[model samples]
Target: MAIARTWKSHSVLPGFGLALGFTILYLSLIVLIPLSATFIKSAELSLGEFWAVVTAPRALASYRLSFGAAAIGALLNAGFGLLTAWILVRYTFPGKRLVDAFVDLPFALPTAVAGIALTAVYAPNGWLGQWLEPLGIKVAFTPLGVVVALTFIGLPFVVRTVQPVLEDLEAEIEEAAACLGANRWQTFARVLLPALWPALITGFALAFARAVGEYGSVVFIAGNMPMISEISPLLIITKLEQHEYAGATAIAVVMLVASFALLLVINSLQWWVSHRHGRKQ
Candidate 1:
């Protein structure tokens, strides 16, 4: 009797183990190590100290403003970014390429330069602000300014994320929906949106995360008022300037935890949406 021959399956890419090891090492060095140091530094503080630092009135106010502004900015970006992406993908217009390139200006421009430019454009004496100030719509040197700055910086993330997904989506799908007696609104709501939902959520999350950690751009426009316009990252910087390393670490850790939780919830929702859509198909 002849013995049966056995064969092993392998991945086409070579050095799987080596690649994985490099990936782990890179992540450990870049991400895990730095995050671990924050926790370790904060551990020097007693629970009461940590609680007091993070829950103080000023700290709490900063947390509220940071999260609130970031959320508002992300929401604004999601709406306008989707619209912008739609226009870019579906239309032909003058300066379309220039407009698309301009969308990424926030990414390449130095944050401080963006901040200065925004302040110059939005200050009470600035051209745009001069026009709006008469109507009592103040923007610069306020919490609203923070939101505006965040919205400016965060817009690119949403646009870039959704743009490709929109481009890949064939126009025939929309035509098919229309042929089935669906109106434009119905087509968008039922057909286009479902396909774009995952990318939209990803963009929103990234924009929110970026806004939360933003410091330079916000600092210039924010006026850095302690309980008013000062953000969490600014607060952390203040602690560091005061040589309160533990306090700074505690605040950072709190922000990290809260951000992680929010991202986790958003990811879970995205997964559910994808799974449900798959099931329906």
Candidate 2:
């Protein structure tokens, strides 16, 4: 008799092909089409013109401020967010629920409103700014202001991402490490951190992406001064206002490509870390 072959597959949901087809179609309509249009519009410019537009002094300055501020802000958020999440997960106190709810304020508040409030609090002669001015430190209308705004908006991302991971982490692991004669720092560094690393990276990438394209919040405090505190999104708007559509699209394309590349790298790192950790188990 001839040999026979058999295959079996299982899924809770039915019509897997149909569901996947719908997902791809929806994504293409919403995301792929718009992005393709942006690229096509930018393609109207010649190579030399595209290069000039992206490499202009103002454009270069905006890129530096935008990426630099975002990187600094994301890094700050990672550290502080981890601490915040740790406290929320490991300890309980009065008004704990209120404090947890407050973490999502940035997600709920309008960006314009947040910008106005930040400017009011940080501008020279404004509450905190008044005290800092005499110390020769400035916040509003400076690159530092941009970083502050980015940090404020991006903090929630890291917190939310890492919070769940921390909650799922059992306290017994720490106890076990201590039982093995590990100090507090050693327990954290050797046990907790490995499990949290992937989530932390994901949060950092999310924060960085959010900060890069932020416009409304950053514009108010940035003073819109070209080559000083202006950001890339603001620069794109400036180009658009001048009817330089091609130039605007060119800049947008650069931002899109750079952000995508950075996120891709971060995601790959997250996957690799998760895979290695899994193998160790």
Q: Model 1 lDDT vs. the true structure?
A: 0.94
Compared with the true structure, all predictions reach lDDT values of 0.94, 0.93
Instruction: Pick the lDDT winner.
Output: 1
TM-score for each candidate, following the candidate numbering: 0.93, 0.94
Write candidate 2's Cα lDDT for 35-136 as tens digits: 999999999999999999999999999999999999999999999999999999999999999989999998888998899999999999799999999999
Q: Output the lDDT of residue 71, model 1.
A: 96
Candidate 1 residue-wise lDDT, 55-148, digit = tens: 9999999999999999999999999999999999999999999999999999999999999999999999997889989999889999999999
Candidate 1 scores a C-alpha RMSD against the true structure in Å of 5.0
- Please report the TM-score between candidate 2 and the true structure: 0.94
Q: Candidate 2: misplaced stretches above 4 Å?
A: 1-14
Which residue pairs clash in candidate 1?
Answer: none
**Candidate 1, which ten residues in sequence have the lowest lDDT sum?**
1-10
